[model samples]
Target: MMSTAHMASDSILAAATASMSIHSTSPNTTNSTESSISTPERPSGIDNCLIETASGRPVVPRRIVNPIAVAPMVDVTTSHFLHLCKIISPNYTLYTEMIHCNALVYHPDDLYNFFGEPWEGKVVQLGGSDPEAMAKAAKLVQDNGYKEVNVNVGCPSPRVQKGAFGAVLMKTPSSVVDIIQEMVKVGVIIPITVKCRIGVDNLDSYEYLYDFIKLVSTTTPVTHFVVHARKCWLKGLSPKQNRSVPPLKYEVVHLLAKDFPHLTITINGGFNTNEQIKEQLELVDGIMIGREVMDNPMFLAKVDAGYYNIPAEKIKSTEEVIEEFLEYVLTEHERGTPNSNAVVMAPLKMLYGGRRGKEYRRRLARAISPRTKSLPDIVRDVRLMMQEMDYGGVTTASEAEDNGGSESDSDSDLDAASHSASGCV
Candidate 1:
């Protein structure tokens, strides 16, 4: 409901107009100048919380206040990444990178290490075909305290296809049912869900798609399906290209959801703007944001406050979040794990998105590259360079120097101790 006057102002004004549209309340509905979106009435029983698909499988939707979810990016959605996400916005249902079922159940220690605390209310994405392997993994996840277990049927990587998993699973609906059923039988009390593509390459027909849904539903009635609205070209496309090249067919997903009224569907793929997210929120039960969430990590920070009417801080500006992360990481470094790459690099990288982040990104990429210097030097020099750039507040070279010295001293001490012990032996 933006008038001509409001439309001409700025992007935030446009956003404000778009956000207010969610509730579609009267134009007069404004509280302190911020528009409020109305949430659906709370359901009576736990049944209301569960996402039951057309097939009748039930997955308890973890009561997500925000419709936003971070898409599971391989190598990126690790425990450390999920922890960082919680720091920025606890509203999101953080997803883990696809866990190989065989690896997870067999190497319990590795699986435990990967399932970090930020995952307490989050979902684990599993990749594998064997029902027993998947079921065993799901039981392990259930025991380890994951809120949800997701079967990944949309990844298009050659590495994954070689193993007859990921996007390839979409072609085998019966197998998916077996996996889901086995997980349920093994006492996976939490909802088990699926992230799948619209269809595979040439087989993107309504019948095939309907059959896929029906088979999974019959065996496991869990309704939380995150459908990336595209047909993955599994043959020649690289995983990255597969994500991009597949033209988004949101209608196909909408059609499926319409036919299967019982299921809760979240549409994904090519949705990058707030307007798009807001629009999709109106259509689907939820929205899984991928690159968009990465670029604008603060996007979901307002969901609880704005949409769900829960108390949440206004979305912090990129600079503000960066400042807080810098302080937190510095504190963590001081406590221990000073040299941990995951701890050090992640927050710094996250800051290089949204408005006015290009220069910082350029400088950081150059500083972190091996062509320039070692990691320790990169950390020291980059902090100094960022200071020179006058990012938010200036950080002094003296502070960077001190941090570098402490790290060097610790490394030296460890090296000396190792040498001494070896000589004594």
Candidate 2:
């Protein structure tokens, strides 16, 4: 069911789309299509968190209070993970893992649980270079209640490379401009942003990044840019290596802030502590915490008090928070989704991170079967472990299995990609 405002917007989208241009694929795309994309009607009444404008008109919440965001890591920043982070620190912004625009534009029906109907302010990031598809996808994101839509231009995975998007798009800023322009013109009500690397491949110079930002920001209405300080290799290096091998030159990002004072610039990469984040926030508008936060979500429990100036009493303890997430698992399981345990456990296991958490992590591994442990048992075991003051993780059932691919493959992509129309980035 479309809202009156939404139906009117789509009418404009279909009518003006004819004038849009489709440039030749930028060599990275295996195939290119200029098909007219149609948006789906999502259930309305989703703007529960929308803020009022000066004119009394409603708009999506564009200003993140502290501006700190959780980086959208595929297979990691799922809605559940973001929800967990939200519970831990309500002020820090959250993002969904980058889903290709094709998924929302083509297989919208199958993605009922993909992004989740976020009632809180959250951003959804999409991967693709097609303007019409990007616009249509943005509409769907708005329709489904995401507060913001973000374009992904930082992923260096081989699969993303083959799709002609992700880090490769850094070489095709024109395509990104076209994509964002269409999204804006299609009347997406939420703010649109881009998450990109400082540089890519041979374009690893600061001037290249500066020029890229100038071109994109000057042309599109996008005002928020998240710059991952590391430059990624589109070739030889695997995604894991790309994240580690590239030395993060954060100074380049700091210079971006110094030069472009108006744009809200966020710095990402290698930041692991509140001390590090607080130090960087003095130079940048915001800081994006990645694997470090995912590895130990408790790292964010103080975000409200430290950054947003919220009182400390409102903050929940690590034990209480994990209990809440475990409760979420129990509630979600009641819905009878086959992958409920697996899906919830994926992020839950990471709750107890680092050396002391090794024992607890091992127990969690044994708890999940091809079937699964009872929800109550999982809760009880966690309580027992914590009651005895152990929050161990990383070491697994056999000290070999769940070491994050040390003993087995981390091929969970198949499960997510099955619902992906084109693919997951």
Candidate 3:
């Protein structure tokens, strides 16, 4: 459990969302029927726009008008990775990897050392049973410029279970309430929220969920609950399997929002298509998409242009985004403990998502191998390889362009598009 001192000291609020928005897509998309669809209006009796804390402190709603977020992947979604993703789609809200309360309150310097970045509008996901420890962790994040502190009661990993935190916390609402109270008491007042599963094992019942939400909401001003709309079978499934096998009862989550009008609820898990997000918006306050964003980063480009109704900018080629980020990474490396070349290459692989993606990843993996290739060597090798594949084995550039090839490739370009790291950034 968390100690009193930490919880009492960690409460806080936010400043503002840095000016960020998604870039645009091809022009033809805007003329399509799907493109003509309008974003639903914000809910009635719900100030669904950017909200304020109880103290009137500015709090941005978990709205992805950019409608795509970089999932809180653990190792794969660090601050550096988030910064990289921002270059591709700056409007996207980024999440911190799951921060264990033990690691957060005790080994904070070490925790921040690897994952920390001071982005003003970022969210911090925490794991712990002790209200005090969790509160302390929340405060640590608040002091560091994070916009929100979220309790991770949705991850079903055995390591997380063993620690009596993560998804397991869903089964203990009183504990969650205590943590929220401590965070509020300590002045870490930026919206404290929960990310959890519908239920655990065969114990899927509205009563369990109702009681859980009722207990916490009544006890503390926790207005946002990010529900991963799947049951987690504590006894039988691995975390990965748990994400899939359990049935998704989105209606149950919608009902939770209907039942508790004052609370803002967002649905997470298994959402891939924009149409799915559009349909979900009719029912919930926000939508959290995992893996999909990594697999197709440009997925939200259209959303920025359509749903949020902002005129989108041109989507930069992966090479362009990578080049800019590499400069940032190189500068950071020079100033501090440099990230391994492999660490840099991992996120870069997301750039190639379409038809030639497999070959692109293979080349990338090779370029960043411990036996390092020079920058010019990598650019020359990859460009030639992609160019060769584009030219039908003839190594012809004019022919590649004549084939209607897009310098900005699609999701079909990558061999494997799924992100392997846990949501950490």
Q: Estimate each model's TM-score.
A: 0.68, 0.73, 0.72
Inter-residue clash pairs, candidate 1: 53-223, 55-217, 56-221, 57-221, 57-222, 58-221, 58-222
C-alpha lDDT score of every prediction, in listed order: 0.60, 0.65, 0.60
Candidate 3 ranges beyond 4 A from true positions = 1-68, 110-112, 309-313, 371-418, 421-425
Task: For candidate 2, give the lDDT of residue 370.
Answer: 40
- Please tell me which model should have the higher TM-score, number 1 or number 3: 3
Residues 230-330 of candidate 2: C-alpha lDDT, one tens digit per residue: 76767756676666666667777876765666678889988865577777776777788877666566667545555555555566656567677778776
| Superposition error at 352 for model 2 (Å) | 2.3
Per-residue lDDT of model 1, residues 276-354, tens digit only: 6666665566788765444444445444344445443344544455556555555545545423443345435544432
| Candidate 3 C-alpha lDDT tens digits along 325-365 | 76765655655644555554456665544356555666656
Residue 320, candidate 1: alpha-carbon lDDT: 51
10 residues in a row with least lDDT, candidate 1: 416-425
Order the candidates by TM-score, highest first: 2, 3, 1
Q: lDDT value for candidate 1?
A: 0.60
Give me the displacement of residue 315 in model 1, in angstroms.
2.7
Measured over all alpha carbons after superposition, the RMSD of each candidate to the real structure, in angstroms, is 16.9, 12.2, 12.1
